[model samples]
Target: MLQLTDVAKSYPTPQGPLFVLDGIDLRLAPGESLALMGESGSGKSTLLHLAAGLDTPDRGEIVLGARALSSLDEAGRADLRRQRLGLVFQQFHLVPSLSVLDNLTLQARLADREDRDWTHHLIERLGLAGLEGRYPEQLSGGQQQRLAIGRALAPRPELLLADEPTGNLDEGAADQVLDLLRALIGESDCALLMVTHSARVAAPLDRCVHLHHGRLADRTP
Candidate 1:
């Protein structure tokens, strides 16, 4: 349940304002997964940031469910993001000091919505049943990533925004992680918007779209 309309974003440069997104429009429905594909400098991440309300667009509207992000103040946006959004980045931004269990429940705790049963279920689904006491550095890359995903999903967010979620893993690991992610998203009925450059990464999604020079084009592959 996300929508963007005539969204444009630009940043100041020495030469002039460099536009990263121009008149971009897109939508994703609840329980639907969509892959965003783009080359470097094509504004894929910018679009994600805007949708996540991490950054404000220079123009246009972003609607998440029934609320318009542009209508919210900074604090309101922050609250909305904390309560409604789940984020996964290329880098597993886990707390080094926190145990795997703590890291997994961190977001849920912060959101004041921690559920022990759901967290435990997520740990099992993510293949992280035995390493609850381990720290991020003690785990493998895939393990750490799974923990990150678990943390994001712990609160049962309405929308999940993932940027380069499998970028650091080998092909086999990537595929495994993707499968787990898809399965979990389906079970949770949370909408997914994943930003990736690989066609293979986008292949499993319900729909795929490519970004080019700040614009979006439907991509069948």
Candidate 2:
């Protein structure tokens, strides 16, 4: 569903251009899950952003589904991201003014694809059944993360991109969230490309790759 070939990215610095990703190649098929493991400054997040259409690489091709990212202008990329991509980050990024249910359905509504049945199903599966009326501030960290996951999946996105999704929670809560996320992703059959630094975080994924010096190598079993 997502493909990156010869991808390279760099940014200007006082010294010179600092390359973050160099000749990175990756592929994630439909319904497949891959964990991207890297240390800080390994370019994992940069690659993720490029795949999500949030940024363009300096070189190389990124094809989401059949459309090459380089071919799309910013507006076109935004539209595609809105319609086909689901994003989760370390921060919940919930609307403070919106209730749990509204937060969950906001993206779907924006995409003009809101389905009540699916929203309720997400609420239940997210363990947010009785708390629909509450706001983000009222929920615990794990609850907030679950709500974020529900919001992402409410539209039934074709692929989900997550960055340190459980970073804010304790170990117990992180496990719970991961379990819920894995189960939901399975039920929806959406491909996943998650960036995490923890080996434990990458263990359950179908495959894992490590990013180092702007290159990718499969994690040795």
Candidate 3:
């Protein structure tokens, strides 16, 4: 459902342009999960951003489903992202003022695709059945992360892009979150592209790839 071809990305620096990704090619099919691994400054997050349509590649094409991302204007991209892509970040970007239920349903509401039955199912599956009335600050770290995951999936997005989604949690919490995430991904049949530095985090994915010096290579294990 997602593909990138001969992608290159660079940013300006004092000396010249600093290349982040060069000649990168990758693909993920529907209901497939791929883990992207890289050291700091290796452009893992950059690749995720490009794939999510949050940023454009300097060169090469990004195709989601049948549409070319480069063919879309900013507003078009925004609309597509809102309607089809789900994003999760390390920060657990939840709205502090919104209750857990509200936060969970926010994206679905925005997309005008809210499914009460599915949202309720997610709340139960995420171990958040009793915390719907609570706010972000009122919940534990793991609870907050689970709530974030629920929000992302509430819209039933076609593709889910996660950047170090478990980065802020402890090992136990991270493991729990990953399990829940994987289960939900499977249930929804959404394609997942997750960027993580830990081998443990990438282990459960269907395929793993490493990013180094602006390119991708298959990673076994």
Report lDDT per candidate: 0.93, 0.94, 0.94
Clash counts for all predictions:
0, 0, 0
Q: Indicate the residue-level lDDT of 139 in model 1.
A: 93
23-57: candidate 1 lDDT, tens digit per residue: 99999999999999999879999999999998999
Q: Candidate 1: which stretches are off by over 4 Å?
A: none
RMSD (Å) per prediction: 0.8, 0.8, 0.7
| C-alpha lDDT of residue 43 in model 2 | 88
Clashing pairs for predicted structure model 3, backbone only: none
Model 3 segments beyond 4 Å from truth? none
Q: Candidate 3 lDDT (Cα, whole model)? A: 0.94
Model 1: lDDT to the true structure = 0.93
| Candidate 2, run of 10 with poorest lDDT | 212-221
- For candidate 3, the per-residue lDDT at 179 reads 95
Candidate 3 lDDT tens digits, 1-221: 99999999999999999999999999899999999999899999999999888899999999999999999999989889889999999999999999999999999999999998999999999898888898999999999999998999999999999999999999999999999999999999999999999998899899999999999999974
Q: TM-scores, in order shown?
A: 0.98, 0.98, 0.98
